[model samples]
Target chain A: MLYELWILAISSLVAATCGIVGTFLVLRRIAMVADAISHTVLLGIVGAFLVSQTLEGPLMLIGAAVVGLATTYFIQVLDNAGVPADAAIGVVFTSLFSVGVILVSLYARDVHLDVDHVLMGDISFAPFHTIEWNGIPMGPQAFWVILAVFIIDLALILLLYKEFKITSFDPALAAALGIPVTLIHYLLMTMVSITAVASFDAVGAILVVALLIVPPATAYLLTEKLSRMIIVSALTGVAAAVTGYYTAKYFNVSIAGCIASAAGALFLIAFLFSPSQGILLRGRQRKKAAAPASS
Target chain B: MQEWLQFLSSPNLQWVMAGAALLGLASGVVGSFVLLRKESLVGDAMAHAALPGICLGFLVFGRETLALMGGAALTGLLAVYAIRAVHSQSKIKQDAAIGIVLSVFFGFGIVLLTMITNGSYSQSSGIDEFIFGQAASLVGADVQILIASALVLLILSFLFFKELKLLIFDPLFAGGIGLPIRFLNALLSSMVVLVVITGIQTVGVILMAALLITPAVTARYWTDRLGVMAVLSGLIGGLSGAVGALLSSTISGLPTGPVIVVTATAFFLISFLFAPQRGILFRMMETRKNTQFVLNNFLLDTMYEKLEKRYAAGQYSALFSRRELEEQTRLPRNGLEKTIQALQKQGLLTQTDGKYVLTGTGLAYAYDSSLLRRIQDIHLTHEAELGSWKEASANGDLRKPRDYLMNERIHSLLTAEQKLPVSLAIKQSSIEYADQA
Candidate 1:
């Protein structure tokens, strides 16, 4: 039960961190780029391993930042060279990810990295890897790492709320107003990279994508204001984390995968039933709008 | 190389390579349309979405390949619909919709996969094979399916080539021309789904998109014509498949899907850097030559203008020293030096006692350059009247301004606007008088 609580805490922190950062990505309409970053950060982990022989240091975050930025850089290169946006994203991420996969198979054989763990992470073991200071046991290492990430993300988002809001809504206006649109974009990307890597040990790379995109997307359907949306997105992520934990426990399935599925389920509910933007309500409004004309 | 050739000669190896090649060919052909339609990542979303369906099929029907493929197709099509629904039904954009559907469905699929792994199903072990594909496990029946799918894809693409071409390039025109745009779009999406279903066995879901995008994009660098691009894309995809299959088979412990993706990306990188006309290397060289040409023209124009000013001021000794030329052109010293050396090598500049003057041929060339500049000035000043010329100039053939001046309509328009240069105006009247005689 204690382990289950630890897993739930870690997963919620992971989801909340992803939720806050992913809000910016969805607003900028670069959710696919986030997906690409999620995939290619595997290469970062492998690279960090190759460099430092471990995946448990600040080197992992640094590697993820470098590779995540490189993924966007390569995509920009292809875009400037006349490749369409989707094809540029598809090609860059896949190629880099394939290289990562090949490297893992070749050099990281002694390590405990496998494709399965990379796809669907094992959060149940989060309790076992506890952090120690002065012979006293702290919480799980993943919990602390993700908590630090969550705090940093929330603080940054709070500090730069106006900058993020202005840049995301109208980049041209932001540039005209001297808001440093490109810098804000890269800053957001860095935060996303850090959050993704921090959540990776608990939720895996792919489910991190789910937690990143699905919660913000669900919140997007619920609210129109950026501040409310961030709050709603984080809340939705926490909700999914809690519910998904129990669901996974009952079914004896992957906790991270179940959390992602739970996030998706929440999105479906919000999509079909949100007061301002639900599909059923919109369809009814459309019918009412058409009735007078038909009559 | 000898060992590779011997390995290729083995019958089993040949069969697997052929199967992979066919899969690659089909994906490449269909992927061309998908890439041109800007739906390259839809194949990726469909591939991920097919996982749960495959698991559901295995749960229900045990291990029939046809049933599994059917299940994959159903969910794949469902994912497309879901993406469309999310995009159109709300304020969420297409990219977010695709990401949401892709990751969520894959997450759900992982849940099912974990269930099957932990379940008491006897044949659950092989189900994981669909995740990271094992090309070595492919048998003759799978190869036969690949062959048939490849044939069907080729034949349909051939039949629909004209409509697909029109649809991708100009959907509005195609719709105005009464083509069934919706049906054609559905046909293309269905073709993508078919490719994903057939390909998941060889390349898996995660990297399946690379097979669809890399070859198509690589082929795009080498061709502008759609028909040629599609054919080239198919051939490149086939080659990547055959090569990747061979390498993975020979390489012990290497996964086939990533190996195949690496092979396709290798082709993409090669094409990106070195293909002619559109390749990065060729573009860099072309840009360099253009810079040189622009510098050359600027130097000649500046020299001609300065010499004209001196002649007008009645200074016959109008030769320019290198320092004066550099100060006048305002170009950087090294570029100025290079341009001067090139002009001298071309015999367009003659040096006398550390001073430079244009040769007779160089004088004529400079005169034409000035005349072209005058015409451009007139065009810009009288842009409203010269709107048609804007389109013509956009073709970038301004090497001979005299040809445009000779056009009676342009000449009369320029004269009416009083925008013609004095020299060209007199020359035009003389030519008109000569034609009258």
Candidate 2:
């Protein structure tokens, strides 16, 4: 039971990191990039496994970053060369992801890199593979790695506080002020790629893609500042992960789907009931304001 | 390639191609308004939000087919109405509103999918495919449904094009002209919902949204005229759908959605590079020519200055060695030498014994009054140039909007209540322009 709690904590922390980075990605209208990166990482993972003859953490990260950066570079190149933003994204991400799918089939058949794990992740069964550290049980390989990543991301985001704010708000203005807008965008893309690949092992590919965008976007509804948005998104991500986990167990369904659905459901509730902005509440407020004027 | 092309030319592939073409044409036509209004992602939300409708239809009939589509379209229309109403009554931004509706509605869909999968439903596995399409699985009935939907959409678009254009181009003028912007918005959103529902089978909900936006965006590079843009967008989309279907069928293990999207991107790349006025190749060539011309004139001026200094020194020599000229003028060896040779042949300079000197005409051209005019013609960002009237802010101040517009010269063009915001409040304001603008 205690071990199960540790697993939950480990899972939540991993989700929180994705949520944190995804906030700015969605705000920058690059939500699709996050989607593209998550999908493209499969190719990277497969490629790394084929080359390195092992699935070590750093090798996967390097492979994923290379593919992810290539995805971003190719996309910007397409757009710069004349492709529409949406179409360029679709083209570059799709092509790379297709290559990834092909590679997965050709190699790594022995590994559990099958469609099911690719879709929903293997967290429920992740606890079975435990490692011992300092003669104490470390539940899964994902636990320590995810926790470290979460802390690193939290610190890095805090460190670059002002620069992220300016760039996310208005990149053109930031550029005019000589804020190294290109470098910042690339850094953000790199961070998105790292977080995406990390979360992929815990929450499956598509669910991670959906969660990264959905939770952060939901947080944006409740806050104006980027700082507040990051905090709110992390909270929403952790909440959604826990709710999704237990609910999936209770109902005996896909945990990734439940987590994604829970995040979506939370946003819906926020949509209907959020003060000042929610659909129903805003309609009522509009009426209340109009009543005095009509009289 | 031959075998692939042969497979592509088959009757089944042809049907799928035809359906995709018609669907593409409809989206391009409808999506023109969506993009122009910068409400593009409204399609994304509508697609996600339509899932519950399919489930409801499934719940009613216990299967997945055309009926589920109608149910989804209806629910999609409802979601659009909700989006419109929320924006109208509240201060929530469009993107946030889209995100909210998209997530919540999709949340409901997940819950429904769970129930349906848990129960006895053959369509469960196939239905998930609607989130990521399989173009190969397109059957005759599906093609007919798509064609019918496309026709219906086309007819509605034609009936409402003028009104839709008016609303998108100028909402206030449209309202003042009594074109019913609200109803027109609903009409367009309904059209969007209809297109998305039909597209789900071929491109899934997520990728369907991409198809809706991608072709239209690609079309934008080809033409600025709304009508032409819509037509081009349709052709690109149709070609993408066909080519994507072909590519996926030929390849052993390619997903249809990604293939279609990649094909659409190919069209975009072609348009971006080859389209007249906007192509990067044309722009680069034009810029290079302008730069070379500037370099040429600067070379001529430097030559004339050397002549003037020599003339001041009472020297009559019309020739100087390459070594002396190289010291006199700082330019790269090969290109400069080539330009000098070219200029000498053009009578702008005289090359005698590998030395070049300015001609009488070249000397006059160096001090020509029209040089500034020629430079100005090629000056990019001339408006923002240094020492311009705008930079110094010391001109007639015609740049100021209030001084120019409401300063009695255009008073006769306005009615009594027209200039209220300008004079009474003295407010500096602008409508938050859409992202497309």
Candidate 3:
């Protein structure tokens, strides 16, 4: 039970952090870029491990952040060079991801860098890897890493709320006002990379995309204001985490997959039932408007 | 070489190779329309969305490949519809909708896959193969399925070639022309879904998108004509599949799907750099030539204008010393010498006693008031445009200039300093154009 609680805490923290960053990404219409970043960060992790010769180090996050930024830079270059947006993303991420896969298969086969684990992380065992502070147990290491990322993300978002808002809404205006829009954009991407890497060992690389995109998308469907959207997105993510924990327990399946599925299900519910944008509600509204005209 | 021939002659390897080639051809043909429609990643989303259907097929009707494909097709179509619905009904854009649907469906599929892995179903052992694919596992029966689907896709695409082209390039115009645009769009999407289904078993869910899109994009670099692009794309995709299969078979531990993706990407990289017109190398060369041509023209125009001014000042002699020409045109000596030589070679100028004289043709070219008038007209129009833009900017209307002034002639006539504003205006206008579209 204690193990289950730890897993829940870790997964919720992971989902909430992704949710907070993802609201900005979805608003900027670059959630898919976040997906690209998540995939390419795998190459960074492998490179870091190859260089540092250890899986447990801060260098992995730094390496992954650098590669993630490189992916964005390459995507922008390709976009400017006349490749279509979607195709450029597809090309860069897949190529980088394939290189990462090949590298792991060839060189890191003897280490903990298993491609399968990179694809589908083993969150169930995360509780066993406890972190210690001066020889005192501090719960699971995964939990602490995610908590630190969540706090950092929350603090940054709070500090840079107005800047993020102005830049995402109208970058030209933000630039006209000397907001350093490009720097903030890179900072957001770096935060996304850090959050993705922090949660990678718990939710896997690909599923990290799910946690990043789905909850925020769901929250967008539910609310109009950014503040409400962030709060709602975080809540949805936490809800999915808790519900998915039980779902995985009952079904004896992957906890991470279950959480992603739960987040998806919540999005569907909001898509159908949200008061302002719900499909059925809008249909009824249309009918009512037509009925008065007909009468 | 003998061993390679023997390996190629092997029956099972032959079946896998044939399946891959057919799948590649079908995907390429369909992917042309997908690319033109600017929905390249829609194929990616559909491919990922097929995962849940495969698992549902296994859970419902056991592990028959056909049944799984049928299930995949159904769910893939559903996902496409869901994307469209979300985009049309909500404030979310198409790309966001695609990302949302893709991750969600694939996530659900992962959940189901986990259930299968933990369950007691005996046939579930090979189900995970759908994720990364196991092309070497193809048998005679699977090859038949691939062939039938590929042939159907080819025939349908051929029959609807003109319609697909019209729809892809201009759906709104096609609809205005009463072309059943929605039905045509649905058909093309279904074809993409079918291609994804057939490809998943070979290239897997994630990398199937590379097979579908990379070939079409690669072929786009080789030709301007759509028909030629489609055929070349199919050929390129087929070649990549065959070569990838052969290479994977020769290698010890390489996964076939990644090998295939890498092979296709290699083709893309080569085409990107080396293809005839659209390749980077050709574009760079064209840009260099254009810049040189523009510089030469600027020098010639300046010289002509100076000559006209001298003539207006009552100088009758057509010949002028190089130093006089340089002083009048304010040109560097080396550039003036080169331009004079080039004009002389073109029979527009002649050298006499260290002086440059205009030939009859050169006189006609220099006195061509139409060219002068055109340049003046361009300058006047640009000044007018600049005035309006300044007024608009002052009025706090931040909208950029529209695309009415992107003429290459105007671009060449502008000086280096003038080109910056023109290019910036073009960029802003093009962005606005894309946004409106």
lDDT of each: 0.87, 0.70, 0.82
Give one digit per residue, the lDDT tens place, for model 1 in A1-295.
7887888788888988898899999999999999999999999989999999976888998999999989988998999998999999999999899889889988998788886777678888879998899999998998888888888888988898999999999999999999998788888888888888888889899889999999999999999989888889999999999999999989998888799899999999999999879999878888999999999
User: How many pairs of residues collide in model 2?
Assistant: 0
Q: What's the candidate order when arranged by decreasing DockQ?
A: 1, 3, 2
**Which CAPRI quality tier does the interface of model 2 achieve?**
acceptable
Model 1 global lDDT (CA atoms, 0 to 1): 0.87
CA lDDT, candidate 1, residue A12: 85
Q: What lDDT tens digits, residue by residue, belong to model 2 across residues A190-245?
A: 88777777777777765676677777867866777777888899899899989988
Model 3 agreement with the true structure over A21-96: per-residue lDDT tens digits: 9999999999889888988888999999999999986898898899999999988877876778888888888778
Instruction: List the per-model TM-score of the A chain.
Output: 0.96, 0.95, 0.98
Candidate 2 reaches a DockQ of 0.30
DockQ (Cα-based) per candidate? Answer: 0.84, 0.30, 0.56
Instruction: Tell me the tens digit of each residue's lDDT in model 1 across B1-437.
Output: 99868877888888778988988898998899999989898889999999998998988998889888998998999999999999998999999999999999998888999998998988788787777777777778889998988998999999999999999999999999999999998888888888888889988889889989999999999999899989999998999999999888887777778888889999999999999998999999999999998888899989877765664565545468888998999998999999999898988887877878777667667767876777777777777866655676777656677676775656765543233334533443353344334
lDDT of 2 by residue, B64-158 (tens): 57678878997788778766754564544555455546555665565576677777766566666666666767778888888888889888877
User: How would you order the candidates by TM-score, starting with the best?
Assistant: 1, 3, 2
